[model samples]
Target chain A: MIKVQEEDFDVGQEIKNLTQENHAIGGVASFLGLVRDIASNEEISAMTLEHYPGMTEKMLAEIEAEANRRWELDASLIIHRYGRMEPGEQIVLVITCSKHRKAAFESCEFLMDYLKTKAPFWKLEETSEGGKWVDARDSDDTAASRWIET
Target chain B: MKILYFAWLRTTIGKSTEEITPPETVKTVSDLLDWMPSLGENYSSALEKRDLLRIAINQEYADPEHVIKPDDEVALFPPVTGG
Candidate 1:
């Protein structure tokens, strides 16, 4: 499952909804991203996330499909939020369920790594001084490249 | 064709979207990039750093060599910063 919205989500409720009927699923791994109150010693008041509407969903679905092909995942979910959000607010979520812990854990990590570099979303931080767009980190590209088949 | 801009690109270009009809010589993403700067100073400034920009055709990532159809939707933006 995938969702792109401005509203916040309940993590516990999402997990329950995905795993309730699945008896074969033995393990679930999830990750939640939150807006930070500070960046580079400056206090951040808010963050505005921007994204391409149709492209965001399409890329997310492709990423999810790749994960399913690589692992034995019974279910997976990715919920990414856009628009203005205050510090400590939930920004994104990724959950993977499998019959074993290893697959669940690894796939969960894989989904996040890919999403960070491949998803069509941008974050602009608003500080006391002014708003600035966050730069893409080289480390993120390195992380995503690790999953490429050699 | 419809050209869309996002984030800082939109801010820099001063518009979110625009419609244009390029000449037949503008066949690919690379060709379009080369010709866009001629439109105005804003386009030239926004697209000055070619490596910093990313492109998508009809919502999918496209390389510089990707062919552009007359009715295609092309988008240009900076690298992603989402989780």
Candidate 2:
């Protein structure tokens, strides 16, 4: 399942829905990203996330498909929210369920790494000074690069 | 062709979308990037980091050398920062 929305989601409910139908799943791995209070020495008051409407969903679906292609998984879910959010608010969630722990773990991580680089979303930090667009971090690119098939 | 800008590119360029027909010389995305700044003063600074800007042709990530058509939707923005 893949969902892009403006409202916050219930992580517990989502995980339950993902694993309830699959009796073959032995393990589920999930990751949740939250908005930070501090960024680049400035105290962030809020964050505004923007995305290409049609493209965002398409890119996320492709990321999910790639994860399933690489791992033996029964199910996977990705929920990403865009719009104004405050510190500690959930931003994204990735969940993977498989017959074993390894596939679930690895694929969850892979989905996150790909989403960081390939997803068509941008974040703007609203700080004490004013709002500024967040630059793409080199670390994110490096993390995503490791997943590339050689 | 339809050109779209996002995030800082949209704010800096002062518009979200526009329609224009490029000359025959602008065959690829890189050529379009080079041609954009010449169209207006705002584009010069908005597109300062021409090499760093990411392109999406018809809603998928595309390279500078990607071929473009008059009906395609071309978007230009900075490197993605989402997770």
Best model per TM-score = 1
Tens digit of per-residue lDDT, candidate 1, span A16-94: 9999999899999999999999987989999999999999999999999999999999999999999999999999999
Q: Per-residue lDDT for B7-71 in model 1, tens only?
A: 89999999999999999999999999999999999999999888889999999999999999999
- Could you tell me the TM-score of candidate 2? 0.98
Tens digits of per-residue lDDT, candidate 2, B1-83, equal 99999999999999999998999999999999889888889999998888889999999989889999999999998888986
As for candidate 1, its clashing pairs are none
Model 2: per-residue Cα lDDT over A1-150, one tens digit each:
899999999999998998888899999999999999999888999999999989999999999999999999999999999999999999999999999999999999999999999898999999878999999999988988999998
| RMSD in Å for model 1 | 0.7
lDDT of 1 at A73: 97
Please give the lDDT score for candidate 1.
Answer: 0.96
Q: Candidate 1 chain A, which ten residues in sequence have the lowest lDDT sum?
A: A127-136
For candidate 2, the iRMS in Å is: 0.5
Per-residue lDDT, model 1, residue B77, is 98
**Per-residue lDDT of B78 in model 1:** 97
